[model samples]
Target: MKKMKWALLMVVVLVLAACSTEQPGSKSSSDNEDAGKDGDKEFKIGLSVSTLNNPFFVTLSEGAKEQAKESGAKIIVVDAQDDASKQASDVEDLIQQGVDLLIINPTDSEAVVSAVESANNSNIPVITVDRSAEGGEVVSHIASDNKAGGVLAGEYLLELLGENAKVAELEGIAGSSAARDRGEGFNEAVDGKVDIVAKQTANFNRAEGLTVMENILQANPEITGVFAHNDEMALGALEAIQSAGKDIVVIGFDATDDAVKSVKDGKLAATIAQKPEEIGKKAMEAAVAVLNGEDVDADIPVDLELIKE
Candidate 1:
């Protein structure tokens, strides 16, 4: 009788342990893990933007937000402030929130590999915008053909200034695909035709562009034209040119509103126009498509236009 009583106690304890181990508010994996699989349920998209300091990226975010509103989907935007580690951390937090899909604009291509891997592990599809990642499974990359735009700038500069004209280059941020590809295409187009007297990096910043261009002009005052990777740097170069009282033709990329106005005012010579809003909208749509299990291309190139007065 004592042995039976002890057995009963042991059984009760075991049952209590089992009950305590059960997760609180737990549901079946099938119900929670695949909520948006059929395209009927609302999707939650995670957007990781590199930085919002520039007006260009700010406009991109507005585009994404607009599309999300129209589709009745939820979007979470995280700013990395140009820090790779911060971006990775933001991505982890986004995954913990159970986002249905991810759209990443990496601060650095190689540095974002770990973040991409984490998303892959969580079984979430990734779509990169503006900049791309070196590793992980990216379903799609959406942006304009930066190299082609560079070629256009180079050809236009060549036409404006004779082949024998000397020129200086105001480069964009180092290690960015935009800077690398734009430089390559421009060099190829102007090969042996024009003299690149002074080429240096301005880090795709307006202040840096001003300082660097000023110094370059001091060394090679004969430079007749300039090719800046982006509009910010080009604007800086324009300011420096004006300060030096130099009649130099400056070409910029990414026709931001200010750049267009500058061109119209005869301050800046020309700029390349990229459909930034289109890129953002397409990226958001692609994330939705991935959630719905629809097909998508690896690379989607937006159209580019040359803006000049």
Candidate 2:
């Protein structure tokens, strides 16, 4: 009987202890279970820009940073310095930082697509700003319509220089989406009306623009107008034209700070102004939306306008 009573007491004690040990309202357990259904991740974005060397890209970066500040989110920016290989390495580094999302302004659309694909393979959503990737699963692309801007520039150039005018074409980087689209639209607008005396790629650099424009001027002294893809190139072309003592009307894209001032000063005749800041902000916002698992448009185009003195 004593042994039976002892065994019964031990059973009751074990039952009480088990009941006490039950974690009915444990925060960690419930939190882990609800993580997928109810919780959001700590927001962090990776912005990989082609180059911070240009004021346009710098303004873009500032815009994205400002938007992130408003949302209390963090962004990690990497500058590729216009190097495609370096851009890919930078993307990998950002991935190692555990960035929740990625924004890429590609140096070269096709070259950057590899990095973009890697991000996609990792299940990280990518939003391209200003330049779209040639190949990748991009969540969204925020940019101005480059083709339309080019057409606008071409039409305006025709109005300024007139039909049967000799013009030199200053192209941007080869294999870039911007260059391709702009060239396509410009060609469509001016193929029959304008005579392209010299078409050369300056790689969208100011110094190169000067050198290339000099060569084109040397070859075609009859060139009456210059069409540069960007302002930096246009400024360089302006310098070259002034040096040659030629009265050539210069039109450029990207109404950057220098370009705007130049336009005001009547140096550069006109430039197509794309809202780069708005593009940056919209891109960052799109990334946030994607992180939250909300639906977003695949293409989000910003507005463009012509800026003239």
Candidate 3:
């Protein structure tokens, strides 16, 4: 009887040991912990773009979307339609959706401050892309050096036109940091070297640029060069100049697809390449880093290049 009882006890001990041992294709407690550390949970990111009408912003959004997919995150994109109030509303809606983070390309720099602050109030980090907010806490600002790009445009225009060059400026939307910085740099580079016949705002609209360029041409018939804040305006101005039978060295920013083709076709004089897609990729990476509690630079700059025919 003692032997039988001892054998039963040994059998019970062996059963318990087998039960505790991990089997093939079975997950142990440590395996589950490791899976958790790998971040099975998907993070949602909100992207508020100023406008998608421009091909540049469209490419930028596409880049961010691709990065989000690769990083196992979701991104929601909203278009402001170049309306500051609408952009603010879109941001409020995004905040209500409990987005983990926000990437904003503001229609207007000053108008976006309130939206940025709202994201800040909710403890959600904000990343600015291509444009910046005048105020509010931003985890990162990703863009090219607009002022430097402008200087490059100016210097190249000077090279093409030389001294005594009479140029007109086609400015972008009012209250935009891009317009302000680019204009400042361009003016600084060409100050006292060229005759700035006319400078006006085209609101960065191609049609408006056409109209504005037409008016500028009428007012300054001797205009020999043009510097538009963006490619849309530059292309518009090009159309106007071509129609008027005038030969003007038109320099544009944001070497968009159309602008690049124009340069290759010898229609556009030159353009500053901002690599909008890269800017978008960097912004998404920064968003992921911020969510992972990793430190990112306050300002992230993409490379810029001068594209000439």
lDDT of 1: 0.89
lDDT of 1 by residue, 4-102 (tens): 999999999999978785487866566655344344577999999987876678888889988887776789999998788899999999999999899
Number of the top TM-score candidate: 3
Q: Every model's Cα RMSD, please?
A: 7.5, 5.0, 4.4
Judging by TM-score, tell me the better candidate of 1 and 3.
3
Instruction: Name the runs in model 1 displaced over 4 angstroms.
Output: 1-39
| Alpha-carbon deviation at 225 in model 3, angstroms | 0.3
- Ranking the candidates on lDDT from highest down gives 3, 2, 1
Write model 3 residue lDDT over 1-309, tens digit each, in one string.
999999999999999988887777887676555232255556789999999998889999999998988888889999999999999999999999999999999999999999999999999999999988999999899999999998999999999999778999999999999999899999989999999989999988888999999999998999999999999999999999999998889999999999999999999999999999999999999999999899999999999999998
Which pairs clash inside model 3?
none
lDDT of 3 at 190: 94
Model 2's alpha-carbon lDDT is: 0.89
Once superposed on the true structure, which residue ranges of model 3 sit more than 4 Å away at CA?
1-37
After the best TM-score superposition of candidate 3, give how far the Cα of residue 190 lies from its true spot, in angstroms. Answer: 0.3
Model 2 per-residue lDDT tens digits across residues 140-240: 99999999989989999999988999998899989889988888888889999999989999988899999999999889999988888888899999999
Worst 10 residues of 2 by lDDT: 33-42
The count of residue-pair clashes in candidate 3 stands at: 0
The C-alpha lDDT values of all candidates are: 0.89, 0.89, 0.93
